[model samples]
Target chain A: MTLETTLAAIGPADEQAMAAARELQGRLTKPAGSLGVLEELSVRLAGLAGTCPPPMPEPAAIAVFAGDHGVHAQGVTPWPQEVTAQMVANFIAGGATINAFARQVDASIMVVDVGVKIPLHGGENLLEANIRRGTHDLAVTAAMSEDEALTAIQVGLSVAGALVEGGAKCLLTGDMGIANTTPAAALVAAFTGASPADVTGRGTGVDDETYERKIDVITKALALHEPDPAQPITTLAAVGGLEHAALAGFILGAASYRVPVIIDGVIAASAALVAAALAPNSVAAMVAGHRSAEPGASVALANLGLTPLLDLGLRLGEGTGAALALPLVASSVRVLREVATFDSAGVSEK
Target chain B: MTLETTLAAIGPADEQAMAAARELQGRLTKPAGSLGVLEELSVRLAGLAGTCPPPMPEPAAIAVFAGDHGVHAQGVTPWPQEVTAQMVANFIAGGATINAFARQVDASIMVVDVGVKIPLHGGENLLEANIRRGTHDLAVTAAMSEDEALTAIQVGLSVAGALVEGGAKCLLTGDMGIANTTPAAALVAAFTGASPADVTGRGTGVDDETYERKIDVITKALALHEPDPAQPITTLAAVGGLEHAALAGFILGAASYRVPVIIDGVIAASAALVAAALAPNSVAAMVAGHRSAEPGASVALANLGLTPLLDLGLRLGEGTGAALALPLVASSVRVLREVATFDSAGVSEK
Candidate 1:
């Protein structure tokens, strides 16, 4: 479906379903609120699914949107840009960290090459939907044309649709790009109204000099474009990476289908900012899987009023954190579906 | 094994294995320390196993120790003591919250009637090892005699050995005792030197009046017993539940076998404190699964130098938090075992 159609279809979570879940939680054998955030999470899932005890969010699908950043030329990170393509190959070969985590969580991985500078050959689980070789250097010019940004987003939407159609009950956002965190910082700043210094962080272990230069690059891009948060498209086009745009679309697509989407690190968080801006109700579908070590991630999550389920100091952006959280998310829903109530179990309540 | 043998068997985690793990972590494809606490966890597991890649902690076993606290007569909790045996029955029937969580994590449940005031009948997975009908009210006198406490601890050690022999790679602590948190708070105060009010919390959602009375009960117990931290048995006999004593032995038993144990909420944390005191090296085998909503849990964990993997505001003491954290604990080791090195993956380092 088109972006407009998806946004139109997305609506607020069902309040009736949330109330039902809350009621069910009180009836459960455990003390009220003893499950803590899990109780709220289950209720939120119910609201998202428009049912009490939302369908078990199992058989998770992870969409790793791989791309390259022209800003990598600006020394935003110490790693060479070629590492992005290599990691994608590693992901395809099932040797990457994300691959191992996916195997542990029993999640299917789909690698979508949205704007990798290096052309990759055919590989199983790889979807080649390159919108461009790479974007323009954001420090020098707009990261991409508004049209190109929209195209990448549509690519994400298509992938989300395909994954859901393939029977994925849950979606996880994964991203891979050299120097992508620079754009993520910029996007987070634009959407959350945070300053460059507050939003920028050490991406891939940048040195002091490279970190300063990365901040300068983001500041320069923001100054040059003067992006408006009210207009998410222009903001994304101004400084967002191809994967960032696509991730936003993927989130919106998942929301349109009323499926829970577990967001990864800073890259996915910034993209979620874009998606939330576009469709306010899309926040209902978002689950902050883990708080990244990246400083900007906390700011973005705070702005969205979402608490991450896991905080393992993970900054690996290839959906490792999100994959780790899949079981916890499933457990939250399972408690609502499978747990016996106080009445049913003949247990006394305070 | 006897408690003395288990304590003697428990030694410090291998430093050489931890160093090797750290070296291997640097060679992984991801940036150094990018895996966050997970890196440290894997390294810790390596040290515990005395190997670079520790054995996978799977086929988890959750031992839910059920008892009734004589403190129930002191009006510390609103719920009746009979609820403890009822919940134990629920666990056997696979209808309790812990059962739901155990099922979600693919863990085997073993319900041990350690000191339940009421006798329970035969059921599969139920272990009838009652040390006493229940402990004496701590506020009035010693919770139990030194001999009874030792017997309960031996019960726990026996259960741990049996579960390990049955092929449980990980052991999770679970406890069920009405008015148990009062004893847990007393234990925390004795070990951590924190005041009773600072450590005491509403157990099972007590009202304001009941909370104040709970705190008073803990304070009175601590004052009456004058429990000493160095003399752990005396302290446990003074104000600890039978489940708490058994849980301490269970932790020591796991450490003796070099198997990791995921400590649950406040009850488990208090028991861990007792275990750590008895065998200082047992701390090496302990993993704080989650920070319980109960205030005392943090103090106990801090004293143990253990940072909980999750802080989900959970206060359910049925090993739910530990069960929830099984995947994360497994993922940490899996990364060490499965993820490729940079050289192996042909990926560049920053």
Candidate 2:
């Protein structure tokens, strides 16, 4: 489906289903409003699914959209750009942290070459959806053309659709891009109207000198772009990575399909800002999986009215947060579907 | 092991292992201190286990200690007193919310009839550890005799030992009682030096009238007992439930063995207070699984210097919160053990 059609079709969550879920929560054999956020989350999922006790969000998929960033030339992060491709290879070879976490949670991983500068040969689990060689250095110029940004977004949309069609009840956003956090902080500042210094954080353990440079890079990019929040595409092309654009499309696609999308850290949160700008209602399908250690993540999540399910101080960006959260998400749904109501359990309610 | 010997044997966590774990965290292929609380948690676990990347806490066991409370006569909760025994049966039948959550986390459940008023027959997973029929009315007199309280604590200590011996690596605390929250709140206030009004909360979704009455009941019980924080056993016998005393023993047992104990809600937190008072070092083995909606839970947790892993507003007491947190706990350890170090992954360090 076209991005425009998906955005146009996005609607608010189903109020009737939400009410049903709330009433059901009260009837469960526990104290009223005792399950706390899990009770609220289950109701929200019901609204998204348009049913009480919504379908279990199982057979989860984590899409690791790999890319390279021209900002890597700015010496923003200590890691080499080639590490993105190497990590992607590690992910496919089941040697990365995300792979280990996904295996534990029974989640499948899909790697998409959205804009990797290196030529990634065909692999069993890799999707060759490269939109370009890599984004231009956002500190010096717009990261990508509007068309390139849109193509990357469509790649995310297609991946989301394919995963959902393949019976993935939940989609998790993952990303692998060198110096990606530079553009991520810039995008978050552009969308959330936060100052670059407030949102920019030390990415990948930068030294004091490199940390200051990273912030300066983001500040310069925002000044050069003067990104309009109303024009998400222009802002995205100006300061966002290809993977970020794709993540936004993936979120939009999940919203169109009424499936839950568990967003990862700073990169995914910044992408969510772009998705929310395009279709505010799409935020209904999003769940902040965990609190990223990055300062920008808190700003983005707060602006989106989302509270992360876990806050274990995670900053790894390869959908690691989402994979760690998979079991909690599944448990939330199981609480709704499997927990017996007071009447069913023959227990008196307070 | 005897309670006194166990308490005496409990020592500080292994500082050598903790330092090693911290050094290992720095080598992981992510930003320094990027994993946030998980990194801290892993180091803590390593200290407890006396090794870096401590053994995985799997094959978890949730001990649901069922009991009745004389506070049921105080009109605190609307539910009938018989529901406690009935729910115990439901737990054993695997029909309760805790059962469902335990299944989701692949953890086993064990129901202990610590003080159920009614005599329970044979059940496959039920442990006949009943100390007495139930505790006396706390508002009028001591909840249990000193001997009864000691016996109940021993029951918990034994359960912890048995579970650890049976190949379970982690122990989660769960409890069932009709008006247990009344004692839980009182225990928390007595231990934490908080005022009854500040620590007391509506239990099992009580009406305004019942909430006010509940607070009054706790106030009156405290006035009569005048529990001494310096004498934890006195406080426990004066106002705590049988299951609460046992849970405290369970926590102490785990600490003595250097095994992790994930405490559930207010009841478990209250028990933790007793455990901490009895053996201050026991808190090292404890992890607040989630923030209980009950105000007393927060006060107890804060006093213990423990931050819950999950705070989904859960007030359900049957180890539901701990069950939800099991996967996250496993992931925390797994991240430390499985995530490739920077040098091992051939990734450049910042």
Candidate 3:
């Protein structure tokens, strides 16, 4: 399908689904009409699924899409690509908060090595790091070719699909990659028409000089590529990393498959913007978990009209924030499925 | 035991637990050290229980303590004491945010009227409400009688005991009551030695005149009852509600039972102060869920050295904030239980 038609034909927010969602507010064990918007969240999801209350499942999958940015050489983040690999090891080791939370909540995790400079030793992590090493220096050229971007997306689709087939009830998007915020800044600035300065944050707590250099590099790259927003694939091709491309596809695929996807922070947010650009209704399957302390995150999420639940000065970009927020999403669905109606509970309405 | 000894006897922080908590941060599925405090949360929990990774069960219970103040008659609150009963219906009906969130997260909710001036229906919920009608006007007499205050604490202990017996793995504390902030305000002032004028806030969005009067009433009440901090029960007897006293007991019981308790906003914080006074270790059982817009919540939590997660500018009290924060706590436990170790995942870790 043509990219525009592909974008246009995605699902809309079904009125029937919304109606079903509203009905669930009154049906759980507690009094009806008491849960407020959390009930609405559940109902909304139910309506989308054409179910009463949605089923929340164990064996959930989180994809920590990792990539490397050319900007790392520019000295924005003090950590090197080796640290990314080391972190991947840490995630696999079960020492991370996401690991702890994932276990506590009984979910599985897959670390997607999307574009690390090092050859990752893959036992279980889906090595979708297609560009072998990392993105091309955005200051010098486009981040990745259109073909590579498309391949990254295919990688995301495969991971999400396999998880769903393996009984994943939900999809959550996470990302890893040192200096990846450079690419995210490019995407946000391009898609949302924000200034590079506005979208660029002191990623990994960079100093004022490095922050200025990072912003300049991104601004320069966006000018060179001049990525087109109307054509999501082209824009992703222009400036997106393999991780961002994969995340966009992951979001779209989850929606197409009819499972909910929870979006993480800026990198995820920028990728989600691409998915939205591709298919408007794909936003329906997405929930904004927590707003990151990252500037671009809030800008992207707000532009898309999604409300984030928590905003605790958190700027970390693993699906950790998203993972942190998942229980709330689960809770939203539970309210739809569990709360009792007024007549059943013998309680009066407000 | 003397109240002083009982408070002192509450267990102190176990360094072994803190170290174990920190170690677990190294094992989760995300990058090493990414989940930060959330990882530590589980680890500390594990250390407290003396388990490598703790047990997570299906059933959980949340207790909401509600109390009214005679200070309400001083024109502090915009709402009346009667609203406490109405909102109790709201909680039961699932119309409240806490109800929506609790059902979402799958926690059983028990509401205690504690000291609401009005009576509830002659039914099961009424049995749990624990309303001694209401507190005495602190401006005139001590808000609660010494005997009544102790009885309220017994009520909290009994409820917590029942939940544990029923196999709850977690305990969450929240509260309701129109004008109860006056009692909360008085408690903050008496304990922190902050000026009553600084601690007294507009309860439930009062206008400027009402706020000024609130400060006046709290100041007068403290003057009337130069409550001793050393005698916590006596202090609570002078200015606390049945719910406040009960909440303190609930926290201690949860700690004693080794169940984690999520403390909600200002009223919960006030009760937590009493809890800390009773036993320093009880704070270990507590997780400060969210800092509410209530001016006193931070002051109280700061006094206890707990950092809040969500900061949604919420003033509505119902244990809703705590309920919302449950997913993170559950994840903390999950990280402990589920994340694969480095050896098993075959990933290298330093």
Candidate 4:
């Protein structure tokens, strides 16, 4: 499928799905009408799949897409590009915050290894992957070669299809890349028309000098391609990383499969922006886990009409934030499935 | 117990509780640690209750203390005190937003006429209560007689006992009182040391003239009470509402039972200030449902160190906001209870 069509594939919340969630919510043992938006969410899921309980979104999949940004060579972040690959290993091994949270929530983690300039040999633990082995550096060229960008999205789509085929009923989107915040900031600016100042923020607690440099890199990259907002993937190409492309596709694949997707932090949110522009209704498939300290994240969420659940000053990327939100989503589903409705409980209502 | 001691009866989160939440979060089905705060909250609840799944806070009792401030006559609000009783009926009839959300979440709703001027009979749906049928005009005297204030709190405690006996694992607090915002504003200001201008906001959508008038009433009331922020409930007796006092006691009672209390909006959060002073740990039991549009609400939350979940432009008073947060709580519990651990999933961890 074409990249543009992939993100654009999601449709509005299905009425039948909502009815199913409401039906299950009505049957739960507690008060008939107590699980509220949770009921709405479950029923929407039900309608999406045209089934009750929406299959529990079981064997959930987290697509941790990794890629490098060209801007990092100019020193926007203190960390080196190798850290992205290192963190991906950290994610696969369950040492990172996302790994900890994923373990806590019981979600299965998939390290896409979407792009890392360093070739990943098939280590038994690490998923050997490379969408053109990272993007072309944005400082000198568009972040990714056009074919590489498409391949990166295909990698994400492949992960989504595999997860679905492997029985994952839900997908969680995560991203890892050094200096990703620069591209995320630029993407937010392009999509929302926010000033670079408004969308750029201290990434990894960067000092003022580094932050300004990051902004400069983003602004210069934006100027170079002047990526059209109307063509989102291309916009992602202008300043996006391989992970951004994969995440945008991963979100779309989940939407296409009629399963829910929970988005983490600014990097994932930036991808979500591109995804949403691709598919207006795909926003429904998304549940924003938390608002990160990253400036671009909130800009993307607001533009996408999402409200995050937590705000505990989290900046750790990976699928961790999304994993954290799993309970809230599961609660929405559980309340729908377990809470009793007015008629079942014989409770008097106005 | 002395009023101070009675208020001080509530306690903060103990170490055991936090640890329990963390461990339980590790076992839930979706991922090792995906649910985030929902997982944390559930496990914390388990530790607090000394159980694995923790009680589902069912048969939930909501205390909606309805009252009126004499300050309304000063033209601070465009609405009359009678609206308080009318809204009470709205709450009882399931016609309000709180009702919709509460019905969705399954918490039982009870209306307490703590200080309404009108004589309303209690039904099966209503909790028969009235703190001297409304307080003295705070524009001139102490908001209510000290005896009246104590009785109002006793009313809250009684509600807690009844709900607990009825099998509730949590106490949800809410309030409805006209021009009551003035007293709440005073209480919040006294505790937070915020200027009246910063803490006072339009209640029920007042015009600028009434807004200024509302601020003046609170500032004048603060002058009369000269409340010491260090002692909150005593400050409540001097300048707050009857319902506020009752809600404070109710919060303490729930904490004393180790039952989590979900504090609704500004009114409840304001009451939480008094509860916090009464029982320094009372703040531990609360879940701020939403940050209200009221200026004092955020100040109160900040002082109490709370973070609310919803921000849907709701400033309406009722346990509705808190009630809506219940499913989130439920979702947390389910994750802690249902999701499998790393050992079971056979997923290698870092």
Candidate 5:
């Protein structure tokens, strides 16, 4: 489906289903609201599915969208741009941190090369959906043209549709792009109208000099583009990476399909800002997996009004945090579906 | 083992192993310290196990120690005391929230009747290890004689030993006691030097009048007992519930066996305070599962210097929160064990 169609299909969560879920939650053996955020999560998911006790978010799939940032030349990060392709290879070879997490949680992995600078060959679980060799340096010019940004988003959108059609009940976002956090900070600043200094963070453990340089790079990008939050696609085109555009599409696709999508760290959070701007109701389908250690993640998540499930100080963007949260997400729904009511269990209420 | 023997067997975790684990974490494929709290968790586990990459904390066993509080008569909670016995039956019958969560995480449940006011019959997964009918109301007098408290603790010790002997690698704490949070608050106040007004919270959703009365009850208990924090046994016997005493012994037992124990809500946190006091090194074996919405839990955990794994506003005290955290605890160790080193993965570092 086209991006416009996907955007149009997305709507607000079903309030009736949420009401039914809240009622059901009250009757469950546990005290009303004792399950805490899990209770709210289950209700939100029910609303997303338009039914109480939404389908078990099992058979989870993670799409690791990879790209390269022309901002690498700005000395914004310490890692070489080639590391993006290398890590994608690590993910496909089942040797990356995300792979280990997916294996632990029993989720499938899909690696999409949306804009890696290096030419990546076919391998298991690899999807060649590269939009370009790499984005233009955001500090000098728009990261990508409007057409390229839209095409990359379509890549994310189609990937989500394909994963759901293949029977994935839940979708997770993963990202792998060297120096991508630079663009992520730029995107966050553009969408949230926050200062670049406040939103920029040292990605992949940059030294003090590189971290300051990273902040400088983001400030320059924002000043050069003057992106508007009202125009999400144009803002994304100005400051976002190929993978960021795709992730926005992926989120929209998940919302259009009425499935819960777990957002990763800063990259996914920036993408989510775009998706929420495009379709405000898409926020209903978004689940913040964890609070990234990256400072910008908190800013972006606060703007989106999302509470993360885990806060293990994780800054890895390869969906590792999201994968770790899958079991918690699944348990929230399973409690709604499986736990007996006080009446059914013959347990006295307060 | 006797309580003295168990205490003697427990010591500080292996610092050498912790150092080795820290060194190993630096070589992992992910950026240094990117895993955040997870890296620290893995290192702690290694120290507990006396080796790098500690044994996977799989085959987890949750011990739901059920008791009744004479405080029920003091109107600290709205739930009937008999509900404690009913919930034990539900736990044994696999119909409770803890049972559902245990099933979700593939952990086994063991419901122990430590000191229910009502006599409970045998059922699947039920252990009749009762020390008495229940504790006296702390607001009126000491909750239990020193002897009764020690015997109750032995019940937890033996249960933990049995579970570990039966091939369980990780232990989780659960509690089912009507009005138990009353004693929990009292214990926290005693151990942490916090005031009743600061530590007390509405258990199972009490009304405004009942909440004020509950705080008054706790304040009266602390004033009467004058419990000393240094003498954990005396403090626990004065204001703790039978389940809280058992949970303390259970935590000590896990520490003695070198297995991690995931502490649940306020009840378990208060008990953990006792355990940590008795054996200061026992903190090494403790993992705070989640910060309960109950106000006292934070006070108790803060005194123990433990940062909880999840903070979902949970108040249910049947090991539900710990069970939800089991996967995350396991994944921390799994990442340490499975994720390849940068050298092994042929990935360039920054």
Candidate 6:
């Protein structure tokens, strides 16, 4: 489906299903409200699926949207831009952390070359969806044109649709882009109306000097563009990477299909801000996988009103956090689908 | 092994293994402390196993110790005393929440009848470790004789040893005893130096009147026995149930074997307190699975200096919370063992 159609079709979760799930939770043998957030999560999933005891979110897929950033020229991050493509290759070879985690959780991984500067060879696990060679230097100009941003987002939407149609019950956000966190900080600061210093953080363990430079880069980009929150497309085009725009589209597409999207770290969180701004209801379909160590991630999650399921201080962005959390999402549903009620178990109730 | 020998053998985790795990974690491709709490968890697991990237804690076994409580006569909880035995039947039939969650996590469940009022039939998953019919009412007298308390703890230690010898890598604590929280509150208050009113809570959805009555019951029991925290065995004999004492022994046994034990809700937390008091170092092997909704659980966890991995507001006495947390524990190890280092992945460092 087109980005516009997907965004337009997004609606609020079914309140009736939520009520039914809550009632069923109460009937389960556990004390009322004892399962904590899992109970609430199951209820929300039920609402999203429009049924009580929603199907277990299994056969999950993590789409690693690989891109390059023109901001790499700013020396914002110490890592070479080629590392993004190299890491994508590692992901495709099942040698990365996300690959290991996804294997452990029995989930599949797909690497989408949304904006990688280098061309990647076709592979069983690789998707060629490159929108451009890479984003323009955000410090000097807009990151991408509005149409380019939209096309990149459509790529994410298309991937989401393909995964769901391929029987993936859940979608996980993974991203790869060098100096990507620079634009991510800008997008978060623009969307949340926060100061750059309050949101920018060392993307990949930068030293004191590079850290300060990273902050200056984001601050300069924001000052030059002054992207409006009312115009999410403009904000994305001005400061976001191709992968970030696509991830936002992926989130919206998952919501349109009424499937839960487990968002990874800072990059995904910033993109979620864009997605939430575009289709406010899409936030309901997103589950913050973990609390990223990045300062900007906290601001983005706060703005989205999402509580991460795990907070092991993760900052990696290649859907590793989401992959680690897949079992939790699955268990939350299993509690509803597999657990017997007090009556069914013939156990006494309080 | 005897309970005394198990307790004597429990020692601090291997510092060398911990250092190795921490060093390995630093070399991983992610930022130096980006993995957050997960990095710490991996180190702790390493220490517990005395090896870096410790064996994956799989083939976990949850031992649900079922019993009856004399405190039921005090009207502490709304749940009927017979529910303990009935729930044991449900557990054996694989129809309880714990059963469902254990199945989802691929963990095995074994119900140990340690102090049930009614005689239970032998079953494939049932263990007859009965110490007595039940404890005496703590408000009127010591809950159990000192000898009986020790014997029950030995039962738990034996179960732990058997499970470990049978190839279970992790042990999860589960408990079932009507009015069990009454004694749990008293035990927590005694160990933590908290007042009964501070630790007692509605066990199974008690009404306002019953809540007050539950608190009063624990307060009176504490006043009558005046159990000394310095003398854990005496304190357990005075107010703790057979299941709680056994769970404490189970914790010690797991520690002696260098196996990780995931403590469940309030009952398991209280037992952990007793175990910590006995061995002083067993806490190193115990992982607080989740934050219990019960007030006493918080006190117990605080006394043990343990932070729960999950805070799902779960008050369930079964191993349901532990089952849900199993994946997180497994993932923490997987990250350490499987994730490629910066050099290995050829990814540039900051």
On TM-score, the candidate that comes out on top is: 1
Off by over 4 Å in 5: none
- In terms of lDDT, the poorest run of 10 residues in model 2 chain A is A341-350
Q: How would you encode candidate 1's per-residue C-alpha lDDT over B1-350 as one tens digit per residue?
A: 99898899999999999999999999988889998998999999999999989999998899999888888899999898889988888898998888888877789999999999988976999999998999998989999999999999999999999999999999999999988999999999999899999999997899999999888888888888999999999999999999999999999999999999999999999999999999999999999999999999999999999989998999888899999999899999998899999999899877
TM-score of chain B of each: 0.99, 0.99, 0.92, 0.92, 0.99, 0.98
* Per-residue lDDT of model 2, residues B166-281, tens digit only: 99999999999999999999999999999998888877788899899999999999999999999999899999999999999999989988999999999999999999999988
lDDT of 5 at A167: 99
A1-350 in candidate 6: lDDT tens per residue?
99889989999999999999999998876778767788899999999998888988888999999999999999998888888887887787777878878877889999999999988777889999888989999999999999999999999999999999999999999999888989999999999999998998877778999999988999889889989999999999999999999999999999999999999989999999999999999988998888888889999999999888876667778898898778778888988897778898777877
Worst 10 residues of 1 chain A by lDDT: A341-350
Stretches off by above 4 angstroms in model 1 are none
> How many backbone clashes are present in model 5?
0
The Cα error of candidate 6 at residue A331, in Å, is 1.6
Is candidate 2 or 3 superior in TM-score? 2
Selected candidate, larger DockQ, 4 vs 6:
6
For candidate 2, write residues A200-275 as lDDT tens digits: 8877777899999998888888888899999999999999999999999999999999999999999999999999
Q: Report the lDDT tens digits of candidate 3 across residue range A178-286.
A: 8888788889988999999899887667778888888888888888888889887888877878899989878887777678888888999999999888787888888
- Residue by residue across B1-350, what tens digits does model 5's lDDT show? 99999999998999999999999999988889998888899999999999898999999999999998888888888888889998898887888889888988999999999899888878989999988898898889889999999999999999999999999999999999999999999999999999998899987899999999999998888889899999889999999999999999999999999999999999999999999888999999999999899989999888888999998999888999899889888988998888888899888987
**CAPRI accuracy category, model 1:** high
Q: What is the lDDT of candidate 6?
A: 0.89
Q: Provide the lDDT at B26 for model 3.
A: 66
DockQ of all candidate complexes: 0.83, 0.62, 0.27, 0.06, 0.82, 0.63
Worst 10 residues of 5 chain A by lDDT: A216-225
Q: Name the docking class for model 2.
A: medium
Candidate 3 CAPRI-style tier: acceptable
Task: Provide the clash count, candidate 4.
Answer: 64
Candidate 5 B-chain TM-score: 0.99
On lDDT, the stronger of 5 and 6 is: 5
Candidate 1: deviation at residue B60, Å? Answer: 1.1
Worst 10 residues of 3 chain A by lDDT: A28-37
Structural RMSD, model 1: 0.9
